[model samples]
Target: MKILGFRGNVDPASYTLSDALPNFGRASGDRSHAHSGSTAKGRDGADVPIAPLVTIAIPTFNRAELVEKCVRSAMAQTYPKLEILVSDNASTDGTVEMLRAIDDDRLRILTSEENIGAIGNFNKCIDEARGDYFVLAADDNYYRPDFVSKCVRLIEDEPGLPIVIAAYDVLVVDEFSKDDRRTVPARLSKKLSTGIWQGTDILQEYLHGRISAQLLSSLVRTDILRRNGGYSPHPCASDEATWIPLLMEGRAGFVDEPCATYMVLRESLTEGFTADKRLGDLREVLDELSAVTAKKVSDPAMRERIQQLLNRYLAYMAAVNLVIYRRGGASLSQAVQKLWGWRTVLAKCSVTDFLSTWRLRSIVRILSPQPLARWMAKNGFDQWV
Candidate 1:
């Protein structure tokens, strides 16, 4: 048995609770940074404390090498007050051994006796996190060194600030490479316009499906996450469930540059529509959105519109995939059967969603020859995805 303690990064003198909190019996801290008590303006015009402790929780499993890179990037953050918690979900590989070799005082590895499942591990990271602010980072993704410092300054605590949007690079790579090396050209991923991206009206954009999971990597408030029930089994929109309320009720932040690199395996990116779980995911997403909308949104009109958008988005996605799949090889009978299944879901969708240029181009690509489709995608088609 081995023990990796938490007595390294946290400084006791700088630690304080707002009103009340459940004590996690953390080890005493000794660190270089101390709170100066300087306050900064939040998005809501209220003053917020600066230099608070930020936790970078990397919930990882057997991807030892990828997680090692993630840990190193986390350690390289320019933020002065930071703690890196790597939760090892009973990995059989050299992940624990690899984590043990890291010498940073900020790095603390929490080992589970048995696999707690991914979502369970995610919530566990939040439950065990000791920072005032938190980031539930993906184990395979690596961040820019200034990822923390930049996002930290933009944080405004109106309460429950779920995510700070940052422009990130998407590195499509081969999953089976001896090296988890880059496979395709890297491109920047964007959600909305930069500068003060969150406010009262942001909820509509969120419900409209503009804030997809690709933008999930960002700084978050610790207590807000726990109060929102952390992560749930939305399997479809797990990130959205935790982040939407806070994003809607509170505020949001966005950095115009790359804070981290989101690594997507080339196979996942290039695979056929039916080959992936997207249709099922989209259906599940609709179910999840209905529940979230009913609970978080107040206005009846707004909730109705949200349902329409959700239905439309689902219809567009399913329709696009169906068209592509049918053209690619699936028989007419199969396509009709799939369409029959989606009929109820599509009935609620607006025709405008189906007529959008984004959808049209996708359909044209699949209908075109392989070479032409590839050329159109690379040349002028809105590969904004």
Candidate 2:
């Protein structure tokens, strides 16, 4: 069988990728004889149960070189029955050609004639996916060999389960030295213990500043996601925005283990913007998220509570981001003044749930003089920008 968008059939069993990429074979290989039927290799290399087809729809724009790792990670999954699509947003930098060179029959290179913006390209991936389950992995992050297998069984065991979120590690790279990289595990709230997560519970906990990670790299039941408006297109808080509507559909699942890697680039978070994305203001982003919640939730009381929580959460996060944004050479005093302006709101938010060890350090980190951010990071504090 040919990969999704490309023509011509080829035997996947004999298809071997180039040996030159930095860390090539570490990724998992095809299951069974040729991935024609599901056969997963367990952590012990023993066979585990396998299931239906899964589509990993990766959206990309340029960065042909960097995306190699991401694609290789998807290709390495131990779980069988897969279709991988690299949704190229009409990149002129040879992105499509680079992906097409991979000989894996399961790999497909879907290109747009014109450059669609990030949101449009993301939606295009969802619309074009044909698998029973779908995963929209960002081109920057890599997945563990068991990422799909980890969550798929849980989701499939419970028919109609909207989604399953696997905890991920954020790859934090030192700004001055590319080689100095650390993986910080994104912790989930104790309130969201591993197992079944109710929709309303997720909605409330997430908005109340309880769940610290994100919903971006979720393993979603394809039909449920499409039935509920796909991913939310909000640029600023699109991470949470995408989850709000889907959670409204029903209860979901959560696996606390780190299955995928979430890249925390200084250029995007600390340095204010990346080559392709603009780090929008958190206040405005949360405002848009509140509006999204209002539309999805039916209860008036829950809506008001969530909005209030979001505002408080906003004050806290914005303070953190402001502290982080200052790393981009922003004036310390002026930024402090901006943070000081939210003093009352921050105080209220802090008294309620900011006593957590990390939260306390986050407060200390933000209030810290501009020079101390790095020191704090080195001292076991996650410098989440």
Candidate 3:
């Protein structure tokens, strides 16, 4: 893995995990910048350390209007110590000017003359973060004031906890500009325990290809992430691909309360089933994950569960790619090619015909292009995806 700065480029693979962590970890303080630690007042200049310092990383690309509110939400956290890092991935919008207007001493900006792409930006933020804990804040999402505090508590107290997933409500905003908001409880399943994301215990829940699997809705231990080499610099579902395996750090934990709001936007990745152009990068990352699991984890049952998870995810990717192609943005041939790629990979990893039948209809619809997909949705198969 290579760690590229806004301008400086450094290769991470050259350094051992021990060396990688402390150098970046020095950035993990309650202080936002090297100078002005004392006068860099938060909201009321009050001081509190109940929560560990969390590096709030917002990776933005032209979404200046919504990004500001997202940054402000991070600033409003009741958790006192926060190091806000805004990574502008070559945004042409007035994001730079907007960031400058904030003028909060606690805020720092990292700019790039070239667009290193989304995953690269995400990796850079993780490599550069200066907090005991880290959050992948969306440019359009709003977090509750207690989000950081609650996450820190879980990470600090839980002995083996690696990542802490938070419960959040999903909001569907009006189609106009970025401001009009319509809120509803994000229909997260009770069966899908937050524990699945916590890394505390193995979740029998299907691991592979579950789109709901995410890192943005969770806060992670920086040390653990660094040890694992941070987020995979991949396309599309790298967050899911990397996070599912990392959850093995401990049983997943949850506050059992909604404290954050995930904004659903048309431009957001979740909005469509389109495969990322960097899907190949994600495939490499998953391949690495399976290799790591075989080496690090010893239990057969756990390994089996992980394999099942990967298999399911691969199938889902194929189905989603079909939808994207149907939507007329990408070519059908490319989607089919990726589907075949996933099938070949998972076949080697042990996805049996029996277990693969779990979502057979959905997979078949992608391959055959039947109207049965609509029928499945009517029959509650949409949730199966």
lDDT of each: 0.58, 0.59, 0.55
The residue-by-residue lDDT of candidate 2 on 1-385, one tens digit each, is: 0011100011111111111111111112122222234555432243433465788988888778767788999999987778887888788888888888899988977777876666666777777776767888777778899888877767556544667777666665554466666655555667777677766676666555445335545777666666666665444445565655666655677776677775544454443232112223344456666776678678898777777776556544554455454555667676667656656435435544333322555556555665676665655444343
Clashing pairs in 2: 28-76
Model 1 over residues 174-266: C-alpha lDDT tens digits?
433545443222223244554455433444553343432232356776766767666544443345446555655445765656567656543
**Regions of candidate 2 where Cα sits further than 4 Å from its true position:** 1-52, 208-212, 272-308, 340-358, 379-385
Poorest stretch of ten by lDDT in candidate 2: 1-10
TM match of model 3 to true structure? 0.68
Name the better of 2 and 3 by TM-score: 2
RMSD of each: 10.0, 11.4, 9.7
TM-score top scorer: 2
Model 1 error, position 272 (Å): 12
By lDDT, the candidates rank as: 2, 1, 3
Q: Best by lDDT, which number?
A: 2
Residue 133 error, candidate 3, Å: 0.7
**Stronger candidate by lDDT (2 vs 3):** 2
